[model samples]
Target: MAPMSLQDLVASLPTGETWGPAASEEKTLNGVPYAPFSKGDKLGRMADWTAEGRDKERGGRQQYTRNYRDQIYGAGTQTGFEIQQTEENTFSLVDNTRTTKTRGFGRGGGTVFRGRGQRGAQTQRGGRGTFQRVGGRGGQQGYDSRGGRGGGRGGRRFGWKDYDKPQRNRDASVVAKPDWKLLEEIDFARLMKLNLETSEGEDIDNYGFLYYYDRTFDKQPGAPTSQRKLNIIERAAYNVTTSDDPVIQELAEKDEATIFATDNILSMLMCAPRSVYSWDLVINRQGNKIYIDKRDGSNLDMVTVNENAAEAPMETTESTKDAINSPQALMMEATRINYMFPNQTVVESETSKREMQNPHPFYNPAEESDPPASKSYKYRRFDLSLEKDDEPLHLIVRTELDAVVKNNINGDDQYLTIKALNEFDNKAQGSGGALDWRTKLASQRGAVVATEMKNNSCKLARWTVQSILANADLMKLGFVSRTNPKSPDSHVILGVLGYKPREFAAQMNLNLANGWGIVRTIADICLQKPEGKYVLVKDPNKPVLRLYEVPQSTFEEDGEDMSVARTGDDDDE
Candidate 1:
């Protein structure tokens, strides 16, 4: 061959020839498809120096990163080219080094103490101390930075190790026998999302009489002039359950409504999502009617104190040293206060009392020693039917009014529902970070009420719901405090505050439609099943409601047993 210039060599080459291999029509080479890659992709290194020893140090986390990195370079399409290792080709390396057993807590050889102090401290016995951190710096004094004893002054007090606190396993109001079958379990989250619009409901009938509310208690709270010693009033008051009431039974016979409930039980169900304590209601479904009733000496009858608090009053079994602040004791004290408050706060004069449509249905003057308390029971019916329903769903609730007050704007008689909130000891362990009511109740009245709303959310919500259900013009909340923090027997009325029922509901963010939805949903559940006795129980620890299809003799035996006990006690006396 003869030597040629660069231009002559280029001209002598083939027209479509190039310096690289010839372009092929087939997209595969050696039966392997070409892996599509972007022009902006960076070439990966065959061996990564920085990645060495990192996989072992990071417990093989680097392998995940390597796989992810490979995916960025179109490794997904190159799977066919990957080598398949067989059992023969794979070899395992076994270490001959002897492993020594170590004594330690958890993973490391150091004990872990959780709290606000030195994480791993040594005990006096030369062993690691896993004692929970007490409070304050260096765990010196029994104080915590987050409002424990002698710390975080003026700040809200939080329970120590709330997460580690023992679960409050409260006993249900009625025991579920082995024969009772669980029908449904609904969570509060689901209940909260349900909503149904309902009407204000019609007044079916009215019973009992109410006295005029004495306006003297409405003076400024915590004032020496306004404070009055809560007197023990002898009055015959009745809390007849739905099925026990003769009027309700008569209405049920007349087919007035599909559901029957009292204000107390209905309020509890409507505000179930706000409740923290364990409560149960008896659901007796007969033919086409559902009656919501409570047992005698039920917790539902008694008002709860701080039942919705983050750290509610504990039982003696829950390591609560203070018996006066226990849940049972507080409930008794609150119930007593609620029972005596309305009677004493009203002017019980025949001339000033407001008569209802009928006289007291359950009271008999010849059989009772004391007169009837100032109360009025109004039977109201609400429509819970949706647009798609064939038949209208109605609920009749026996609502109550404590007293009748004359409106200031118009002299018309305004119905009132009075409820008292009792205070035990603000400085007690489970006081729910309450302020000193005697001091703050006057100057910081809003703060006191706000704190109460936070602590007693369920109780207050129930009261509000009851007030609304009764169509009361005003809701009176009396603040009653113990004469001695150490003694719950003696209490003095601090003051009384008045709020419109609807306005109060608005303040609490309580939606009547949502409550109606919950009630309707529960009613529909029972209506779907056959005629049987059902028990609706609020879960103690969890925000859940469970419906149990109990036997016919479930609560009947309980009542009989209680009656026998009472008779025996009376005979012994």
Candidate 2:
């Protein structure tokens, strides 16, 4: 009486009281009484009866009733439940003790009829109509002892077969969004030098940003099944002009210029192999044939001359033998090349961050009309060539083009710009699992940058993959993001975009090193650009040791065919 607790007061209340948990009692459904908030007893009995298997000795009508009841209501052994006809042709479950009636399926007790009713059929007829579960959850098509078939008036109910039926092909139509021909016509040499075009057809200028579409499975014809839309990554957008004529400075200050960077670059590198031969070509117009420039590796004097010579014929023979020896592996490699930039441009500057997010720092703002200073650097093309014959099979990347000038340029005036380095050597030397190429490549500053870029690209790629697979819809569908997200670095060396962990490891071990190896030869040439010494890069594909020299003149002569010549004449169009 002093202070009644809630529990005590509830126990003290009368049965008809408004509160106090409503005097817990047996709840009933369809006349079948069950303990309030508990269906365990009823469900257990039903399950036990069904587990005993169907009783075949019962009378024909009784057997039909039992099977039909079990199919419709699942082990129909509810103690106080009775199946009764609520109408002339309709049936219902009635819990007589509880004085309750249920129509369709329910948690406690209910009547569920499968299959539609036929016009001339009734329960009194010669077993013409009987309930048969359709194609639904926990529903299976089965024949009733009394009914003619599984579905009423028919031998069987039509399920998925209706939709699966074949039909005539649809009419021809045009593609909604035409595929852009901009990347197709470019030669590999020029592709390395050209900037991406904006939606309005204006050049993004000086490697501002490249648009990356998810082409993981886009090798086949037609639109890609996944991630077909372009994702623009902004780099140098000082020259980009939108229809609104928005101020470029305002856009930059507002941080509106960049959409994505490291990820985009990583994606491009991942998809570099797709455009290997055509990387250097860009056709600003439709119907223009993609022509190769003099710098084309396939068109090089060494390639042409060597092909005509013993080395060329030997290469063809070796290639055929190699294909025959390992067709699957070689085919995989061919597919991989599409996503890798065998020849990549990695620009370095004194003030730019190691990430190299933007190349604007290398641009001369004072000379608004002039091209960026980075463009003036000779030997713009940095190529990564494979050497399958190497002891462990490695890659050698070098500049395909040479820096030539009429004036004798001293070493101090001209320098070798190591654009980018791809770590293709990643084989484990011993039990420690350390990459032999890592230590080998990190030997020089130039190679260090390339190694860092490669490693960092893997990190970025992993993160992007994680974010994409973490989507709720994707996860619900049982899509595995990665089997090993934290193991051996990405398989960029194999030119394969990393997806599953084990797959990446297998490919990496087969084709690449775990980390990176700074080719001392290439890095040394890149670091010490002194005039007398020539930068030597051995072409792994060719026997020739390509020699590059920096001329005395640091700048190009006016009217000199610059690195990229725009002779389309249809620039305005």
Candidate 3:
């Protein structure tokens, strides 16, 4: 090929290769130091891509939306009043059937008088003194139903009428949890079930059980009455805390066999939404606790988790020969996880593999692992399944503040929207028969964002919805370590902490286990650096992505691995 003259170059140039003289430069979000756009970012550069109901949204053939946020699929515009009215009507029917029985038992001479002292023999009236007895008298037959509204000295049992509007105000309080009822029934019930498992356990397990209480429900203003405490997921057989620390904590750990590149990235993102805007985690000084809420301000309950939540295998661990997996999903194995506090780090191991003389029927982990060393129980789980098996592009993010967790008018709508994506999405199918079950289960919990095709040569481009709870700190309950061990991908978690699971796990010598582990409140966030390049990530606080600290990134760069040049922070050992 010969070089052409400047005049000849213009003549042979391809069409639509350049902007015309009339084209004026428009500011983009890609400029350095400061991003041109934020939460409500708007721009002509990517407007069409950002528009609703469009393909090329995060490389999908469908539109990107908080699809679950609408009435058709979302929480809908339904009110708690409607639920209450329904509940009341149902309760009324039940009340009618049992009103005479329940109210009478509380009021009349039967159990009431028996408690009052058997009409002068020996019992204290233990109920609120409000009864009306009008039967069994005149001494015609002394064997008649001999009892009066006896406990008329006990306190009045407060009913719905007793609660007033002023008493339900959250004006002076902080909503640490969401109304569990407002969430999808299955999701809420699952959380409650986990709470019960822990609470009902003996020994040190209760604290682990109690740790998930904050996630149990949203604690609405009045509808589904709740104790006005820091709204826990489940109450213990005793509302007991062995330590004065107030909140109880637990943890689960495992190392993914992160030998390859793809596995590494997927492992990181699955932990939580790695978006910069999502870094705002909740830190409550009073409870000495923290919670991760999506941008919409609701708890990130880790519903992707299953029974034995910390023992599930992840894609990376199972896909690799030397992989380690979390033991969350295998019910065959019994596992438990907990933490060594103050230091807030982790250590994991296996327990007895032999069965006892008599076994209490449950998913027994002990008897299954013949030699304990032969144990292998981890089922991989993915929160989102794709229509296409191709790789899903993810953008990590980081933020400066941790958002608060609570319930409010705006927060409720946001919760419904998120649930529509999370809980409902998993159950929704775009088109199908029972075979499309997986397709319909369409849950997505990230926020929608956009990107371009290239620097200058572009039409409408790609977009995505990122998650606010990436790299979360999780506390998985029901992890029984005595039998089943944890896998590398932990499904049960207290919730997410803002830190990469890989780097943080390494620092703690972490190995995913069926039992508990706590990552001493680590915090940070991830996000794309310099925009459209979509390759670089920056965490001002975390050094994992810092060029200076990780001189040679362990992550794959094209065909090369950055591991050789990788180093911890120079400031660190």
Candidate 4:
């Protein structure tokens, strides 16, 4: 057992065997090939650090335990493990080289990898694959289909908080019948582009008398001394429609004008582009004549408050808890104030009143108890003929004047058209951001007027157009406020302000040429049709005008009843 030489120890081993271990017959184990390695290499680890670095550079993770297996055995080497063939094994393949598809769940399930600077990266999971591109700055960013924000510069986005606003659904003033046939549909955009210049209309006849305007109301607003409680005066006032006026009918029979309308109806048509509420006009076409009329109890007779407001007063419903601030109540309150305000602000002395060429046409002293209000009716004629027309188109309108004021510069009488803007409650829901007129009218008059212009654009536009049509020398706007916010019966005149019609129109950016064009456009549509009655209606929810051909007997019943009533009154007189 002494220490032997290295060569003698190796020679003493059994044949086909080495000193370290038994020699194998082949370079394979259990039918699996062996991987070659150098003895100088370091011991293998459970995880390959080099493979981890390479996987990270590729921008993703590899299968779990794949790296460790490759390090220990070799790359692409599978252990010779197999299951015996059976019924379950015959259903699917045992090969791991191919990927197996998986079923997805929940709204196209897949992994969404969102990042920057890694382009052409794909993810496959749950039977779905998504190709993603992580782009850098200055590239087109992506957005979520569910309205999520994408990566980009930040600012206010479009349609932000659109869901928070309330929806407005208004009803039409008149319902359409099945027998009526639609003739034309026109939008406001097309009407705005039209233009027609008209001259100062000619005065055909004058009726009714106007008293002098009481200058006391022109005192400074919000002053304790200037405020006057509105008095309910008894006066005869008439709002005769065009076709119902006897004078207009006489003029029509004489062929004085081919087209006839009252100031109220004509002004509504002229300023139609500014309207928000639905309105309609009745057109009767006789032989070579056209008459623009309004139905009985039309909305044209009611004065609207905040009709053009962004958030107008809501209608009364079971869900609406507030009824005083509703649109119907507000309109009724405004109309009552307008009717009584002018009569209370005029001088009623017989010596001081200005008489027109004719007496009150619609007033009968024997039948009526109250005296007539200070109002004048002037029948004026305007030319709406185009250069290419074969015949001249003339429009005669029955315009009314409220009162007369003496000019300060020349001491001559100036005709005036009076209108009032009312306030119910500034703190109400649909006040349109109006200021308290009692405290702010004197100091911030301009601000109050600007707010009114924004809230009542359509209303004020109609009044101004009416004044211009009447050829009034001055347009007076009275500020009237409710004494109590809860009551509609009691009101007081805060003050009165005057503006020249043309100057006010310029301030409002009102184009007369555009208004004339609207009238002519509507008129031409009727002129081309056969002799019959037509109706022009304004859409409620949309800014459009629809012309329909109605039957000749559409409004004949109401007209006949009105005729019978008038005849009975005349017989009693």
Report backbone clashes per prediction: 2, 44, 95, 0
Sorted by TM-score, highest first, which candidate order results? 1, 4, 2, 3
Q: After superposition, how far is residue 457 of candidate 4 from its true place, in Å?
A: 0.6
User: TM-score for all predictions?
Assistant: 0.74, 0.19, 0.16, 0.71
lDDT tens per residue, model 3, 476-536? 1111111112232222221211223333344322222100011111211111111111112
Worst 10 residues of 3 by lDDT: 455-464
For each candidate, the alpha-carbon lDDT, in order, equals 0.77, 0.24, 0.20, 0.77
The C-alpha RMSD in Å for every predicted model, in order, reads 14.9, 29.8, 34.7, 18.0
Pairwise TM-score winner, candidates 2 and 3: 2
Best by lDDT: 4
Expressed as tens digits, the lDDT of each residue in 168-262 for candidate 2 is 22111111112211111211232223232111111122222122122232232121232122111222212111111223223334433221112
Q: Residues 1-573, candidate 4, lDDT per residue (tens digit)?
A: 699998997888788774465655567877876878787454534455465664564344654344333453343333444344568745754444322232222222232323322223212100001212233333333332212343344211222232364456666677677889999998876887889998999999999899999999999987878999999998889998888899999999889989999999998988887787778899999998999998765778878888765456776667763477787778878888889999988888899889999988899999999988889999999999889988888999999999999988999999999999999999997786689999999999999988888678778888999999999999999999999999888999999999999998888778889999999999888989999999898887777889999888775666653453233123212
CA deviation > 4 Å runs, candidate 1: 1-159, 318-322, 557-573
**Residue range 419-469, candidate 1, lDDT tens digits:** 998889988877877888888889999989988987887889899999999
Query: In candidate 2, how many Å is residue 408 off?
Result: 60
Query: Considering every candidate listed, which one attains the maximal TM-score?
Result: 1
Q: On TM-score, who's better, 3 or 4? A: 4
User: In candidate 3, residue 55 scores what lDDT?
Assistant: 40
lDDT for residue 34 in candidate 4, whole number 0-100: 84
Model 2, runs deviating above 4 Å? 1-505, 508-515, 525-545, 554-557, 561-573
